[model samples]
Target: MASTMSRLMLGRTLERICKAVLLLCLVHFLIMMILYFDVYSQRFDIFSRFNNGRGANASRGPHHYYYNYSRPNTTFPSYLPGADQLLPTAKPEANRTRPTPKPIPPCPEVPPGLVGRLLIEFSSQMTMERVQRENPNVTEGGKYTPTDCRPKQKVAIIIPFRHRDHHLKYWLHYLHPILRRQKIDYGIYIINQLGEDTFNRAKLLNVGYTEALKDAEYDCFIFSDVDLIPMDDRNLYHCYDQPRHFAIAMDKFGFRLPYAGYFGGVSGLSKKQFLKINGFPNEYWGWGGEDDDIYNRITLNGMKVSRPDVRIGRYRMIKHERDKHNEPNPQRFNKIQNTKNTMRKDGISSLTYRLASVKKYPLYTNISVEIGKPPPRPIKG
Candidate 1:
């Protein structure tokens, strides 16, 4: 009888062990599945409906269409600046010859001519799903061009980005329609700073110019801030007779040009025009100096900012707190002070960066570039 009981106990023990092993294997499989989905597409399981996501928030109201995480808002140090491993590439069909564009006003007029700046309303919150649903015609990669007419000029609109995912959704929601209306053959680019270092606005713009050209021939380049939305479509996106400053007036500055040299918001240049200035200076480490430096580069290149009358170039800046690392550069005025002296030697001709990844998302060509910290300027006497 005692032998029988001992055998029975041993059998129970083996069964328990088998069950535990089975449980562990199931857990491992579940974990791997979660990670794979997160990395590949970021789409969530049914449980995602409960997560509201991060950064900005919004209720599913009348504007509801779809919902998904745009991107992680976790702050990261600047990516270690490295040389680009891969040059930009065109999509498989990018080289296909397009139909020649019809005349500029290929579509119907909306109120006829530039009726001055129209006031626009921006929602307090935005969503990746909403943008996708509304712009169904935008295709998988945030690219759109009028099919009916061959555009007059091809443009690359570049936005330097960091931790502002919601702002980007809004930009797409508005700009896609506006660009289509303007009849521009354009591709949207969001050049994202990859590291947790201080945001280098100018360097990102330089990378945009390089990567955009590498992918295709875009003769006109528009360097735009993500937060600003245009109030007027009349601020034609096509290249002008000279470099055009698109955001001449902003509601932030009372819809007026802030100052004579204020070129911070939105500006444009043809390929030859951008090359003439040798591109923007790569050394403006923080926010304040780059715009002024660009203006100086323009001036040094024997060019001037050809702005539309304030009424035609109206913009509304989406409000947000300044980023922690983007504190106003006390040295900005000094940087501007030396634009002419340093521009010839320090602009795009001297630019260097490593391309970490170039992802073509449904909405834009996201070029992840790693730029190094700029060398400190020698203390001026």
Candidate 2:
């Protein structure tokens, strides 16, 4: 009977030990899950060595990460793309040279006109000179850094322009105030195609990007059409995990998305993201297929497009007739259908353009370039 009692006590202790182990495992799994979610949501990209506008983490000290353990090695940044150079960086330890981050500007209370719609009466009263007079905050070379403080991202606004000064006047009037209210450091570059060659929207965009970089390092580029303007300030202009389509709703499409993959009108792309796909194709001359080509490039590179909710992205396109010598490219259809074949060879890497002139106005910078001509149309294999 004593032997039987000993067996019973030993079994009970073993069972108790097993229960404790299971409980500890459950607690550990729950903790791991919480950490995974925080990192996934990008609440903080702590390991992000430089300022990719991932926001600040005050608790991070100089020795947060170490290569040699004896001393902090701050020489090499993470293996981020080339575009990462556009963002700011923290001061490295021991006077190491690194890009310093710009300060955060104060967010002021800015009101919009009636649900963010521009009344004809209000907009008609706005003039180009009036807009210029209102913006006294611009720095040298038509750059606007937020007056109250530093800004989150340094943005370069690239407008593809050949003509349409009247449309541009309206755009400057509406967009400048909206961008200022958003409190971002930005500059405007109006890329104009020189001479009477067929309008190559994509090549000009490539030119705009290269030229803008020559002037200042831009974290992101907003390729905006001079004729289209956003109605709501809520549709913020910034980069994300993927490219973003700001014109979610346009009057041209009856105030809704025209199709599933339409990434036209005003759009945003970080430099790294743009470079990953070699930028837009320089072969998409004229107006028809460049935007679609851009969409395909993004998708092919394992990135998806993101946009604000439809209600937030409402925009109005200023109506106009097609400009003289700007006929539709007959080859757009064939090129778009055969994107998978030509994309690798015909993008920014192969882009060619001659700088004709660069002019800085009170509102923005204007860069005129000779994009030359598109190669003879190719036959499908």
Candidate 3:
């Protein structure tokens, strides 16, 4: 009986050991399968999106373990850990490549006849935007463009220019935009005196009128001082039936013209009216009498001076010392009263100036004229 019982116990122990070995083998197989799937399945999933034909169960006879994890119809894996050994899934298609992009067109060169139009178009959009933002009541798209711009029948812009570079810069910056917005196809002539000979403001203006007409016909002439910048764009540069004193409300006189006949900062004249009074006197070299002389000429010709609403004609005078050449003459007033009487003898037609040279620049042409010395004495005869 004892022997039989011991044999039975040994048999049971052997059966238990066999069962444990079978369980260990099963766990090992599962672990290997897990490792293989973790390593290869991720890459297969990525590449499967790009290619639709490569089957998920594609046969890999020797590496059949990886075949089960292979996923097709997916984007190719760019940086698979062991992918350096594998071939790249996608290749370049010679016909599928794209062409290079083209360049944009540049702005056209500005022409004299079209300069005003170009300016109008350039500022039109910006002006409209600004106007709408500031005043909601104003109409949109009303800003004038080259296509819609109309040349004023009789308008002129005379700019008195000198060595003040700062003044010129500000003048161009502010006034150009203003003039374009106003849509006045006005000729802008800067009467720049070339030399240091007692800056003859009035004579330079006469030169501008002559020079401007040579380029294109302008029926009206505006004598404008460069330093004065207008506060209002509404103050039209065009002449009314009467002479227009556009710069009546300048800061120099508390934004108001000091007297009734003030036409100092800027004044416009029609061709018939200007020629009727024989234009501005070429004799007054210094500042004071020239404007007064012009005023006298207008009054003498039976035309009255018209003014803007004093509220709107305000202008800012750039601060600067009086030009060295334009030393204030003590006798300027004496000559001012005589301009009307002497108009026929000392005007544009009677004036004489030597043409030094003309340099045609890339932009516009410049003709340098040597306006002869101011008469030794005022023409009081």
Q: lDDT by residue for model 2 over 1-381, one digit each (tens)?
A: 999999999999999999999999999999999999976756345345445334465325532333333456634445544423332354436767668878654544342322455542234656667877877776545677765665657899888898778888788887877777777679999999888878888888889899999999898988998888888886777677789899979988988999998999989999999898888888876668899889988888899999988877889888889987778888888888877887789888888888988988888898988988767766879
lDDT of 1 by residue, 244-327 (tens): 888888888898888898888899999999888889988777768788888888887777779887777889888999986777
How far residue 377's Cα lies from its native spot in candidate 2, in Å, is: 5.3
Clashing pairs in 2: 103-150
Worst 10 residues of 2 by lDDT: 106-115
Q: Which ten contiguous residues of candidate 1 have the minimum total lDDT?
A: 80-89
**lDDT score of model 3?**
0.64
Report the candidate with higher lDDT, 1 versus 3.
1
Runs in model 3 lying further than 4 Å from the true structure:
1-145, 357-367, 377-381
Question: Between candidates 2 and 3, which one is better according to lDDT?
Answer: 2
TM-score, candidate 3, is 0.59
Q: Compared to the true structure, candidate 2 yields what TM-score? A: 0.68
